[model samples]
Target: MVDVYLFSGFLGSGKTSLLLNVISQIKESGRKPAVFMNEFGSLSIDSDAVENGVPLKEVLDGCICCTGSEQTEAQIQSLLEENKDIDVILIETTGAAHPVEALDAIYSPIFADQLNIRGIITVVDSKLWLDRSRLSPQIRALYMEQIRHAHLLLANKSDLLTESEMATVSMELANYNEAAPVVQTIGAKIAFSYIEKVLHSTKEKSDTSIISGKGLPLSSKLITFTESVSRDDFEEWVKSLPETVYRMKGYVPLEGSINPHLFQYAYGMVSWLPEYVKMTPRLVIIGEGIDSIKYE
Candidate 1:
């Protein structure tokens, strides 16, 4: 069975540069890799990036973040049909396509049973990553999910980081995922042997109970509520929260919980699937400023 590797990162994070390096390695190893790039609202800039003889199967449409599940599947299937013996696939997702959700869309029932979902790699731009504060936690959650689920992560653009800064980033990453290897590279120029060394473990079956629902077009607003009480009383109050909250999750220590508890409400839906850690739970309600709390 052929493998599919998804290489993604935020905008200007050297995804094309890294992909070129990997494709070159695949060529030298007497293997063929079909390349797919979904550059949202643009085209692939492969002039300086491609040096190898490997033919790239380019798809320069918008990011497959939401649509194109069937089209993306068809593109891959067509490649396989053209080259029935191709060794692997390398898909470079557009920066806007939250990498995990993009992968989920690909692995839907339509395509999930066909291809082996090999890996998802995210490259972080060290210089500007920390300053990205457009709903930092939400963005970071997506980034961290990519890192947490990856078999390998190449922290490309190492030149931007000092030795000390690299150490700090490494430490921070380790807190969440020490199992995956973190490689430092410049312009994603890591050696081929490093990538080929590990037989990437197969992806765990994705767990997204909420993804199947059609997300209503919501004009999201942020409202915050803070409370202080014993952990027991705090949790009791949390369970009784008005259902207008749409995805409120953060860590604020309550008076009694030994650890910080995180809570979330997906608008009208109620889910306690994610195990809650003990912490002060502050709720950020995302709903209309209007009184829409009666729906529940």
Candidate 2:
């Protein structure tokens, strides 16, 4: 059984930056890690922050997150079969993905006993959120869905807001998801030491079982950044993102290899280690307040 963590965030939420930071921490700790990335674009991205890049040929060759659940299930199973050394499994879901569906796809019967779903981390863009209020109905619904299902809600890009504005955004998030802890971070930066440790057990506060509401998009203005990467490069890129967009994720293919790397991020905070087969490295950082775009 492997420890699995699902990293989810809307477009431009800094998921990639977070993935890189978390991966470095995992490596620094002397733990072998494999990153599973689901790039929604044709030009697969790679993470070059590390010396050893993650290969992509080994990962599912398509859109596993949005295409449906069966393939996604097969993707996880296939990875387990190909590489058994994976100590922890980190899933970098697509930006357009519904956080719940990402979890459901991996929670298949085959993986149920083998993998433990520690928690769900959702990233939200404070700037985008403010705009969500004025977006069309379909878009608003999507924003609500993301916030409602978060186990840990990252009120990212806090630097963009004033003290009073920060409180207002925090209050708004609480209204939709009072269950998760809404922490502010910069550059999606966070210490990776406790990511998996903290996620191993689900926090009672972020439970979505009590949530009621069928997700229905009210607008199409919701944004997301879709790409792939090699685990190593992904690492540096994520840390760099701590200053860029809001979120990023997907797998990174190590250079001169076929096996794909996996990772994810929210705002600027990183969570969980990427694992599959064998790999390990150590790096950790915790950003205070909202994540700055530079972290993206």
Candidate 3:
């Protein structure tokens, strides 16, 4: 039977970073890892970050807990059928997705016998969590629900917080989720061995109260650049983004660079990494009412 681990986290919480860490560790340990990634946008960006040759499947433009659930199952089924040697399947859910409903979708009887449901591993952005009150009620509730249902909680981005802030966030998360072990991490880094041990030892079942109906009023817009843009201009554009914008990521062609840079923005933080190959210059902006934001 293949072991499956679900990655649950709010938008910009570093789920993809943690997924990369786990994949590397699994590969080093001589275990084959496959990825099932869900993106809320029309284009699949993070899937590009997965190492080449690893079996990957994507559910784009929908949440796996809702509209994409059927496709998720089918993709997982296809992944398993195509890769018999895979020891583990790392499912990185859309950041906005609810863990409980996602679990409900994966616990289908169709693959029940073929897979082992390891548990939900949640990555919480410590800073945004501290500022969660600023978010809309529904988004805040969804964020909390993600943490409440985690089997293993990762307090990611702890480096950005002060000692006192980390202490407060850790305490609150502990109170919210007493069943799972909360580990503070930088860049979502954690030893895969520790993750395996904690998961194997945990016996507590997830909360069964799955939130039904439509999710938040979140949406994603795909923007493609026909030509390279100056770094200063791009940064200016990013600064102009409204507070409603939650996350933005994609490959961007920058002036003077031979290849497109991997750009990521979350909760007002921006990062740019150089890429070796030229990729389609596209960006996916995810937020509430983002369709009005135009890029000329």
Candidate 4:
């Protein structure tokens, strides 16, 4: 059976950075690793940031916990078929995803005997969490859902908080999720040995039944445009996007540019960079109640 690792956390919680470190550790131990990335938006920002040479399968424009489940399952099947010798498959889910749904999607009857779930690692931002009380109830529910199903919770960015504050954060997380063990670190740096130990111990405690929830109504929209727009106009449009649109990403061609820029937006953050691979402009927006036609 192939070992599967699902990394879940809130947006901008350092999942990508920690994943890079984990992948490096796995490679040093002479294990072949494959990655499945879930992006809340359509653009492929985090996939590009991943170090070169790792085989990548991406599910874009939706969270794997909900709307993107079928595609994620298919991608996992494809990855296993293509990389017959891979030792482990690491799945990085969207920040807004629920681990319960993620587990459901990947736990297919066809792959029952072939796949073994290692554990779900949830990353937390100590700094941002200090103000979690002021966040909207919807966001707080999403955050709790991600952690409640974790096998290990990584309270990252501990350098930003004092020892007492760190303890408080850990205690709070424990209140929401008592099943998982909490490990605090700065910059999401964790020793590989500790991670392996956590995986083994969590597996010992896991039950045969999958976790279930009422389920969130997450949706996605993919839009393609044959025509290219000016860089200035594109930037302006991105800045004016609605908050209901949790994430948006895609490649966009400029009127006079040779290569199109890959754009990604999450929460209130927006970024655009020239993509190495040139492709037609295609935007994907994932969230609740998004009107794709309005953007077109």
Top candidate when judged by TM-score against the true structure: 3
User: How well does candidate 1 score on lDDT at residue 218?
Assistant: 16
Total backbone collisions for each predicted model? 11, 99, 0, 2
Error of 3 at 246 (Å): 29
| Worst ten in a row by lDDT for model 1 | 210-219
Lowest lDDT block of 10, candidate 2: 216-225
The C-alpha TM-scores of every prediction are 0.61, 0.62, 0.69, 0.68
Predictions: Cα RMSD each: 14.8, 17.6, 16.7, 14.1
Question: Local distance difference test, per candidate?
Answer: 0.56, 0.56, 0.80, 0.74
Q: List the residue pairs that clash in candidate 4.
A: 43-249, 43-250
Cα-lDDT of candidate 1: 0.56
Off by over 4 Å in 4: 202-296
Backbone clash pairs in model 3 (N, Cα, C under 3 Å; residues 3+ apart or in different chains), count = 0
Best by lDDT: 3
**Superposed model 1: Cα runs more than 4 Å off:** 46-53, 108-114, 130-141, 199-296
Better of 1 and 3 by TM-score: 3
Could you give candidate 1's per-residue lDDT for residues 131-182 as a string of tens digits? Answer: 5465478766666555664556677777987888877776665565565567
lDDT of 3 by residue, 1-296 (tens): 68888899998999999999999999999999999999999998999999998999999999998899889889988999999999999999998898756765565444545666666789999999899999999999999989976778999999999999999999999988777789999999999999888776643222221111112233344566788999999999999989977667678889999988988776899999998977767776655445456676
Q: What are the per-residue Cα lDDT tens digits for candidate 4 across 234-276?
A: 7677767666666666677778777777776767788888877
